[model samples]
Target: MSVRCLLPLVIVAIVAVSGANFKRREFKIKIDGEVSFKATPPLSSGKTITWKFKDLQGGVIRVMDFDYDESATPQNPLFKNCASADKKTGELTLHNLTENHSGLYFFELNGKEQMEKFPLKVMRVVQKPEITNEKTTSNPDVVYLKCKYDKVVDKDAKISWSCSNDTTEELAYTKTGKTDLCCACTLKNDVSQETSDQICESDLFHEGSNIALTVVLILLFILLFVVIVLVLMYRFNNKFHDYVFKKYEKTTCLGGMLKNLDQCRSGKKTGVKQTDVTTVYTEVNKIEENNKEDDPLTDPQHDYEEPQSGDKQTDVENGTPLKKEDNTPTEHSDDL
Candidate 1:
């Protein structure tokens, strides 16, 4: 080949070789910890990859090496130093691992391929699980049981599910990115009245972490008790009002007074004569006046003063003065 033709050919060969190496050298990240599962990155066809862990002491810990065959028995690499891998699924497990095992790892594919670096984050599983019930109603068709941790857990960690009252078993569906996991269960029978006594529990196992849900039910019971007390108080107040009205009816003479007055006006029998009414009214007035005079608060002289003797004589000659009692006080004349 001519010099110019050879240069283009050489460049094409170098480009082809670099492209092949790039595909084979693509690195994948695997996160492992006390409770984390092995995570594999998507790999291209015909690629080979190996995992090596680098400790803080600069010591290289060989994890695993495997070829990327789309139809391989163990598709994922199994690190003898760490844990084994499932044949069916490409899941890797790390045993007796700590956070210090967490760091950057390097993967070397085929010979003459560049090494690829990945980050292996090792997280401590939550020691205790926090369980909560978010249902607000007394009886709910479905109840949410939330199992959460204070921090973010590994996304590929294996979680186990269980309950306190074995009458109903809980199942965990998926892992949440926020280190918390939640599951929903349908209530088999009506539990409106029975929820106070029944408790729901969730157990998460990074290393046997568990949480119970009983405090929420206790609070609901206290609220129900308060409502019952208020209802009883309202009933008592209504009964008290009725009792007061009945007592007042028995003590007062208003009924009797009205009945007597009605009979007198209707004239069913011989009613009181006008003269008799006038005489009785005059006697009652005299009694009321005597009572007033006896009271020191009343000035009897100002209330009943007599007219002069001259005025009385003139009134008598004119026939305007009625018969007067000699024993009556002089103040009585002024009153008339």
Candidate 2:
């Protein structure tokens, strides 16, 4: 397993041996070495008290007894880990606790009722707080920070946050397992007053100082990627423009009427230049006017009305053509 993954097991083993190898500096070793208990009111002189130890795996055993009749028993040599008690005070002291001492211990006054219970748990000294930056912390105004430490015992440890602004904030820690507290906070954009730098620091422990660097690198990489894409798009923009213009210039597909008109003109005489189109239309109009003037039906002097069908039929039977008589209508014979 990786170092980070195996770290917890190693810390637990150290804590497993800490009760014997090293004692907590804050508490006296004598007091730390053993658990002491005494009955109230000096045990009332004549009354007695009994101390019992319940090893979770080994079963329950009576450690010692104090008698009001001046007969105070010594710690059972059988247990080897307990010491004698004061007969007058009815106090029981458990000494030189080892790994085997982890269990429950209780006291009984005069062997009648349970007076107090002691649950002994051995723990390793808490290491310095380990701090790490949260991964989702992308905001510049507020930075997310996390503090975690090994917890070997049930005792509560303090994790405090301090800044140069003369402010002390107690960080609330959440218990993850039997021996771990993971706490997080969103801090202001300003540098930590304690670290004397931009990063946060604690009196007991200081976390890795490179958290900010990693975040910066990630952001720079993302920005570089965006810039590259934009440059590529700009480089080929001319090709895209050419494609659109050429496709749109295909008049046959868009302006059908104009395309047909061009085809019709191309099929005509080659001598006729497209520039002479206006002149050709003017000449056609003059020819139409001359034809109209030559037309006999259009002559101003001709008083011509169309002949009746009957007249035209008779003329046809007689096989004689009708002549224009004076200022009247005319008929035509089939014989003519």
Best by TM-score: 2
RMSD per model, one decimal? 22.9, 22.4
The 0-to-1 C-alpha lDDT of every candidate, in the order given, reads 0.46, 0.52
- Considering every candidate listed, which one attains the maximal lDDT? 2
Total backbone collisions for each predicted model: 3, 1
For model 2, how many clashes? Answer: 1
How does candidate 2 fare on TM-score?
A: 0.32
Worst 10 residues of 1 by lDDT: 188-197
After TM-score superposition, what is the CA distance of residue 10 in candidate 2 from its true location, in Å?
Answer: 54
lDDT over C-alpha atoms for residue 39 of model 2: 55
How far is 307's C-alpha from truth in model 2 (Å)? 99
Residue 279 local lDDT, model 1: 42
Clashing pairs in 1: 304-331, 305-331, 306-330
Error of 1 at 282 (Å): 68
